[model samples]
Target: MKLWLGTGLVEEDVAGVSPLDRGFTLGDGLFETLRVKGGRVLRLDAHLARLAAGARVLGLPLPAFDFAGALRATAQANTLAEGVLRLTLTRGTGPRGVLPPAHPAPTLVITAAPLAPPAPPARLSVAEGTRRNDRSPLARVKSLNYLDNILARQEAAGRGTDDAVLLNTRDRVAETSIANLFAVLGGELVTPPVSDGVLPGVMRAAVLAEGARERSITPAELATASEIFLTSALGLRSVRSLRGRELPGFSVAEHLRTRIDGA
Candidate 1:
């Protein structure tokens, strides 16, 4: 695979980085996954904005590069017309301590690969005894420290489900392992607020801008939801079932998918 590593695109088996790189050692980094359609990246500005915001939150320096141009070049180099592009930014190499360098440089890596065919609709289960700290700043940013999500996904897999639903400390539905959650309750479209420890997903913002409401949703409320769906950079996907109970329909998910595609 071809990857962009600061200088330019390289055809390499492994992308190298310093052993002391904070991103590798301490998970001090941020990443953005973008969707490319017909050789063009969708929502480039929004992705960069999120990255910048995350960098500020982490006190990490932003790498000096034309991110959009680099993304396009990497996609072209890989001949990826319709696929996913992942941009990773790290707090560069540091000493053997937790204290960061006063003048640290940042590392940027971009990789593109063709997307596989869509899998079956997701079957979810509430994660076993796992909840995000709603008041933690980390909850609002996409940091490299994703062990919680990984473990939650594993718990779901152990139960033979596609994903796990994570709730916040208040027992409010936060999100799934990798995507934002939306439900059709009382014939109204609602999603858990970001304040509830849900990551402010790009697609989630679009859905809300396009008229989805934000509300506190508990597991009990979710059980009564007529329809449920998940959204991420990969796109909208309907939920087939939650905790072994089948959901009714996906009309709302389909409509949002069409609206996003049209916009």
Candidate 2:
């Protein structure tokens, strides 16, 4: 595979970073996973806009580059007409200690690879001893610090499930380990508000733009949902079951999938 590191495209085996890179040392960075179809990135503007927002919140300088152009170039370099593109940005090498350098140079890395075929409907379980803090600024940003998600996902895997649902500190359903959650209740499409410590996913935003409502969703509410699904840049995936109980049919989720595919 080929990747774009800093200014040029290079073989994946040749890509390297300094030992003191803040991103590697302290998870001090941001990233975006973009979907590429027919050589064009889906929601390019939205991804960049979100990255810009994250940079502003973290006080990290945006690296000077043509993001869209670089993405296209990297995809072309890899001969990827349909795949995933991961763009990562980090505060370049810094000295020992937590204080960021006065003059920080940022590192930008873009990698593209073919996407695997979509998987079957996901079986989900609520995480056992973990909760998202809705009030934390870190909850709103897609920083590299994903140990919480990693461990939660591992817990689900140990239980022989595809994913785990995370709740907020107040026990309101926040989202799944990797995707935004949605439910159809009383014939209305609803999802947990971002204020509930959910990542504002690009695909989630698209679904809302198509008329999904944002509301606080409790575990009981999820239990009573007529249908459930998860959204990510990859697309909408139906939830087959939650905590060992079968969910309703996937009609609503399938309809939304059609709408998104057509969009």
Candidate 3:
């Protein structure tokens, strides 16, 4: 029951709480898991933007946070190592009612652990995804409620794949379990637009911005691409070796691999 509530780090006794906390009882919270590297977080600003966006989605009054200071503290708490950095902000203990309290204090916790990058991905596996409706408010928020992703991950594992590429109800590619998907058709890198029911991932946004700057992605030209790839804070970038029975790799993938590897 150790927790990081507000600015001070405290154990359960000091923090003083009950077992029926709203976050524990109803998953009333939001969180972000970042991959830390080089004493910095990848695409830190983008993560903050997403966090704010998620708060808005949940109708939660976000803590007036010092974004940079938290990163510095998290880096120190975590040390310089390849690992996961997670920040969870829960609307603090509340009474038994569906209506949220007027003056709610947020409970904040940052978790960190060591990590080692995975071996170069030889292939990306595709599995069925939970068809999330466009109106589902949670889709836009990275909330503590993750039953959808949990079930999706479990099904993906049984399908004998590394990860699942979730699709929208329109059958368009949404994203992966924990990453964003990009495809190259006609030598132009293409990814599903954010409006097409996918989280605007920080790393994904960074790569797209970079590619656009380099004139690598041409708008609305990805449907004719030669290959498809995925990226995340941890994965960074990996090309899909095969899609179903079709071999989707291209010479461009090799080139992109070189470019991303060099980064």
Top candidate by lDDT: 2
State each model's CA lDDT, in order.
Answer: 0.90, 0.91, 0.64
For each candidate, how many residue pairs have backbone atoms clashing (under 3 Å)? Answer: 0, 0, 6
RMSD in order of candidates: 1.2, 1.0, 4.5
Winner on TM-score between 2 and 3 is 2
TM-score of 1: 0.97
Per-residue alpha-carbon lDDT of candidate 3 for residues 162-221, written as tens digits (9 for 90 to 100): 666666666666666766777765556667776666666666666676573222233223
lDDT tens digits by residue: candidate 2, 63-100: 77799999999999998888999999999999999999
Model 1: per-residue Cα lDDT over 81-123, one tens digit each: 8999999898889998898899998888898889878877899
Q: Which candidate is the best by TM-score?
A: 2
Alpha-carbon runs more than 4 Å astray in model 3: 1-5, 10-18, 122-126, 212-225, 239-263
**After aligning candidate 1 to the native by TM-score, how far in Å is the CA of 42 from where it should be?**
0.9
Spell out the clash pairs found in candidate 1.
none
Candidate with the larger lDDT of 1 and 3: 1
lDDT (C-alpha) at residue 249 in model 3:
60
Q: How high a TM-score does candidate 2 get?
A: 0.98
TM-score of each: 0.97, 0.98, 0.80
